[model samples]
Target chain A: MEALYHVAPFTGYIYPNESVVPWTVLIVIYPYLTGLVAGAFTMSSLYQVFGMQRFKPVAHFAMLTSLCCMLIVPLPLLLHLGHAERALNPMITPHTTSAFAVFGYAAGFYVVLLLLENWFVFRPHIVQQAQQRKGLLGLFYRVLTLGSYDLSEKAMSYDRKWIFALAVVGIPGAHGLHGYVGFVFGSLKSREWWSSDLMPPIFLFSAIISGVSLLIVLYALSCKLRKVPIDLDCVKGMAYTLWGFMMFALMLEAVEFASLMYRGREGIEMILEYVKGPLVIPFWTVQLGICSLLPVLLLSFMIWQGTKGKTLIVGVVTCAMLVLVGVLMMRWNVVIGGQEISKTGKGLLTYHMPWVEQESGLTAAILLMAPFVLLAVAVRLFPPWEDGKAAH
Target chain B: MENKVEKLEEDGRRKFLRLFGAAIGGGGMAIAANSLLPEAAATETPAKAAIPAIPGYDWSQHHWAFGVDATKCIGCLRCVEACKVENNVAKDPNHFRTWVERYVTLEGEEKARIDSQQDPVNIAAAGAEGKYRFANRYKDAKVEKAFFVPKLCNHCTHPACVQVCPTGATYKTDDGVVVIDHTYCIGCQYCVQACPYGARFFNEEKRVTDKCTWCYHRITKGLNPACVEVCPVSARVFGDRNDKQSPISIFLRNNRVTVLKPESGNAPNVFYVGIDKEVG
Candidate 1:
């Protein structure tokens, strides 16, 4: 492990320290997961703030998923730090010029908003749980209620008003949440790959695509598990939303790439080579071709022709899954591809993720899956469904 | 009367021995532990700062910069070795506070084939005279222009590394040297990514970001850094640029020099004579 830091297999002139890429798969996962939270929160607003009736059934569930994902966004960052214990230092004493200094505050504010909004929206259920359940579970529900057992009509209206207000605030908070991730990379003037004005919008839209996709897929799966009919209207609505955002994200990315080529930035050729070489298959095949183009085509066709029954369900599910993969690929390209170019314009470098379980490929894979575990725990606790059916 | 007196004397001796033992055990242990504390705390003691404080030394008055005469560099790797030894830099090929790169560009090519050997230089070839060949593997290839450029922290006036440090762990001193506060560095490597010169590295042993400080300790003591001291050809020079009589100031005035990657707009303080466009 120690040897890897110093003995970088570089092809050309790179600073000795620049030889080994510092940010790893863990950093990649950081933005990827946070983007999901941002996207999910925005998708929930489709019903809450926008009053899209079809999105109503899964709005609360979207909030739950977003919150769950948001909770785990900092896990990768914490793990990546050499001194994980001092993670609070940035929050405690933020350097004003540093873009990353805003992370702790942004994340804290967003999480608090999500918690408050979620609690108010689910207060009725909490009161019921507090009264109906027995022993530790009932005690836990009572504690979660925070001493408010009001089940009156007036109180419910007030909760609704607060929920509405919080949802309005959450729209920009969602953008701020993940847009800041883009700023962390974009603000870096050193790396040509990440230093761009369009990074925030690109990150934000892609985040929406991933979040909406995850919710659509999960909502469909939950309905299936409960032996209930699929919410075709809801699924189609999300698919359309996903399609619009994914198209915007893809377009912005294309513009960024085109400008890089036209302007002939310092490391443009190195990045082009990166896309052509080791990244060829993944960049073109999985990320752009299969995941992006395929889903865009499928979703567009579904929205235009209005397919019925199984075909529509299959298309929406498949497109959602592809978008999820596409977003992850985008993150991989941004975080890892940015490091491929050497600071010395003369050459390029490569990085291979290690298989070691602690801080390597397997560990990143496990960390990516960690949100789902939390989601499961949250489902057991709060029940994101209105039917009171368990989320399988 | 004799027995009582003898008993009283014995009791006094026992009391004295107990006090002596306690003092030796407790006080001696405390003194030893204090000495063994990490250098961070030890450097804070008044004794450590008493290194003949240079007369009239104030950070505000001094603006430091580095100079390199690329034409005179023999690529002996002495500077690289000296820097690592002096700063306790991790002996990693990829982790260097200072290093020498030998650039060889063929005719009619805009790009140069550059190679850097940061490992200890091998000078002990038996039967060989004083003339020593460098670790340049491309010696046999078609040579057009080849010269060695030693690189170190530029101590930029507007250091990107210091700008991106989340906790201000890295900062530019009033004296114009960019340095990392290892005690406060979170080892996030944002500064590493932000540094255009690739001067920053994560020291695995220390678990903190490390960079060339232009030998902050030695500079304050009115001494040359280990690298400058060990350079056989006096190719590397570092001093206050404000000092009109300093070698760096004289060299800057006399030589046609360029800062690496002037396009970066980092305003690097390290000026190089005979630096090629191909060199970073």
Candidate 2:
């Protein structure tokens, strides 16, 4: 006797097993990653396209981090789905069922835009230098340039126009990526903690901080390792930007809490249960203490000293930790924190990250590390600094 | 002679290896295919065949639209066992087919226990103290009006899972059952997390979420849902909510029934009578 039968195919788009809580976790995490990509890229453009002198040296690192995080941006989302293979259909053949389809668009579009923008901006110098090196090194640059090796005066000018246009186009795509992510959570009518009017803006601000912090750290590390001179102005400039964005993100989160608590609605109890008890550690320790505060402190010290090597080292360490802790907390809070409340509102929901989960703890950590590994590899290969005047 | 023996031995070794590999590979493939393509032979018979759900598939109308005369329940666990078999829900403690929730409320001089699992079935809490101390099946109210209300998926009309699915891997059947396409599902747990009812489960082994599915297997075969069929008191009701003359339509007309999260706009198809305010 037949015990079971295969269910519907593509037509069965709803999750058969969904209870109320887990769905909210997914919508929140995806946007957080996209916001980081957008925020970081925007900082890069401030120097490269807008001609901010202090931000000039920070451009290459910004571009590199953006590339790193952008490629793996969809990892958490893909991990949550029980059927990973079917994850691609939204990207492959998009059918707009809901606003969520916008994520599908942002994912495909940004990969190309980032690659092209980075190529046009970096190609001329890369190709020129690659031509000087012989054998495999030269061949690597040649292949990278893809036969577009004209480094003439007009060619460089044309490259600038391309970068400007790509950056302009990228601004909206970046917003869409983060906005779409915010929309995922905001649209849910269920769970009060998730339903918020200010979600998207909060996402954007935090993402930018994550981005600039990544550059501050990366720039310092590159300088120290390569024994190059420190660029105080660039570090300070990015720090200022990071500080401004972090304040905004923190304020927005506060406002969200304020608005929800002001109503003292039925769901407020659930939110308080999370903010006070189980979530106190991750929220206060990692998010407030490590991710935001320590970096802000170091960056402030660097800003005050405004000196050469010392400022760079402090800023570098601070930036590295902020980028790592800030974003990781953002992911953790959204995924686990949102589910901390039960629909009953009588108690809390439980989620201990089990090993066998598709997005198991270890795999998630590795996916997040992909950016640094790629950055290290990119630096060894491309060396984003100018000839001998590398900024440590 | 030595060369010939060597060649013969090598050939023998190769054949043995080939047979061994084939056996292992064939066995593995069978297990893999079984999970991917579940068996349907039993469901193909005339009387037992799974029926294709027709549109206007309102679950509120199913013959098993659960209704409890709250006075009868005494916190037994029989219904939970009956439900697991009907749904083939995982018995792996992590998965629950049905569980009795017994609640006690004390107000001033009034004290009462409301265990939804009826007097005949509350195995887990049989010997425990409650309103109906000497009851198994609800013959009459024992202590100051304790009520029982069975809970399951509210099988929504505008299910959030159907809305958030990226790959169209989730959809509502014409009969209104929310079905999952495991093959097309990317194991993305979005739908699993999105469902407010927590009626969803990620079939961790298959990497696709699976949940109550309302026993679509039995329904199409013109049988009641697993929980409905096993009730000794004939309390479960199933019918076409869209059909004016259906039993559900008559039941709803005669009784006061309510749905979960009426504001969620998911349009739950499950209806409850003799309700609890905190059912959501």
Candidate 3:
């Protein structure tokens, strides 16, 4: 008989003494970056897709979020590896044979859309803002446009198409970028927890949920802070979108559980235990209850005939909760939940977050907070909704 | 124990000298496992020059191999310590070239508690009053059987690390060995994800990626891999897969050896004579 002693152990969980293997660090960075992408693009789509003239106020906020989020997409995957420096080898000499790689186009392609969309949509307004402000702010606006001060009808038309076309292309690119992340997990055959076919859909749906929810929350905050009137009807419309996407997101999560539970596949039962245990609170409190169900209830109530301002208020609050809970629970389900199963479907692996693991909770929190700081700077420069007086 | 050491030393010196003698043997035997031209062609024409030949290292001439008896693994830190000293792996929280993982499973079922125990001590530090089983400090957990797998780069014949290096910074040696040309690495981190075994790691200090190199520096001088040399139970084996007469060859012929994650298709050169199915 063949004995087990010929090879050392192989499992994903990092032992306490061995601090180098960072599962949590990689997981947090993944969702945080994806959240921003979802947040920015969904914000843009509200103005373009649903055609809410009022939500058009923060269209630029969508653009800025997309750019900032895309900037840090590579950092998480880089830090996840044993050899971060050798990361370039695959990009430079791509192995067509290995399917896991080949995401080289994700960065340059998305950046082009961002730069174009920014130029097309915001240039004229930035120039006008600069003209009004005589100090360094005006010079900054002029430089932002590279000195093309054209305000002709032709320019306005061109800007709309640029916004429309990029928005169209970016949706698929956004799907591809985030879907590729699902591909990263889906490709790994070592862990059955990540091997589900539903990973791509779940990730994509969650991205939309996180994305749209962020827009609702951030836009409401921006308007309230500025003492400006919010487009209540526009928010009600977004609530519909949020509710629709949330239904699918919740359905997908159920499907993921049902499939794994139905067959009781190798470690699926144990994984369910972790999800229903270590991840139970996050899953129920943040993901299922607050992130998913609460938003649905709010939107459903509005659909059954509620006032615009009330629906808007409920919609914004629901979105904020979804944003906080959706991304957090998704991360825990992946990183912590995956480690709780045995390779042989025999027993369980236990993991608890200690105070100072390299990529501990605090580290993740700091990285997550950085985008808000960046977003604040961007909002000040190009407020999504300009005062109506400028329209005249 | 003293008698065993004395008896083993009788033919040791000259045999040890010849181990490297064969290391410099060079030429006539290399396995270009990732030729990618089609396996049938390789089977038909076995005489093709798989390797163009390099000084002191030749895959065609590779004859040394590695072996391990899992039952004997006491989870000592000797091999890990030796690899660190030999390679100068950084002591940062993010760097690791070679390390030991303890896989603690439930008694009857293969329920696994897998984690890295960075520094492993002898049986004493395992902290048990009466049991023969080893205890992992993370949970002070005990199990029926604890398997310790010392993981490093497998040095595959078709290494994804070299295959993905955009700058040609990583390449397989003339001896059918894979190596990273560190100076050329741009640190984009693509190879880090491409590895099926999760073998390649990013080195922030050097701003490059690193993994096990089959102990190229020592292997060139006819010495065994640090892990192999330091293992008390001879659990890690290294040799030329092409040499049908080598001990690694005999073991492969006699045992049901396996590679980690054959589905990955990298065709790793490092083969375990008796690896479990759950690992890959």
lDDT of each: 0.79, 0.61, 0.60
Which 10-residue window of candidate 2 chain B scores lowest in summed lDDT? B39-48
| DockQ comparisons of all candidates to the true complex | 0.25, 0.15, 0.08
lDDT by residue (A190-301, candidate 1, tens digit) is 8888889999888998898999999988888878877778878888888888988888999999998888778887766776777688687778898999999999999889
Write candidate 2's Cα lDDT for A111-181 as tens digits: 76788788877786678867888898888888887655567797678778768877876777676567656
Q: Give the TM-score of candidate 3.
A: 0.73
Worst 10 residues of 3 chain B by lDDT: B24-33
Each candidate's interface RMSD (Å, one decimal) is 14.7, 15.4, 14.6
TM-scores for all candidates? 0.88, 0.78, 0.73
Best by TM-score: 1
Error of 1 at A31 (Å): 0.5
Worst 10 residues of 2 chain A by lDDT: A7-16
iRMSD of prediction 1: 14.7
Provide the DockQ value for model 1. 0.25
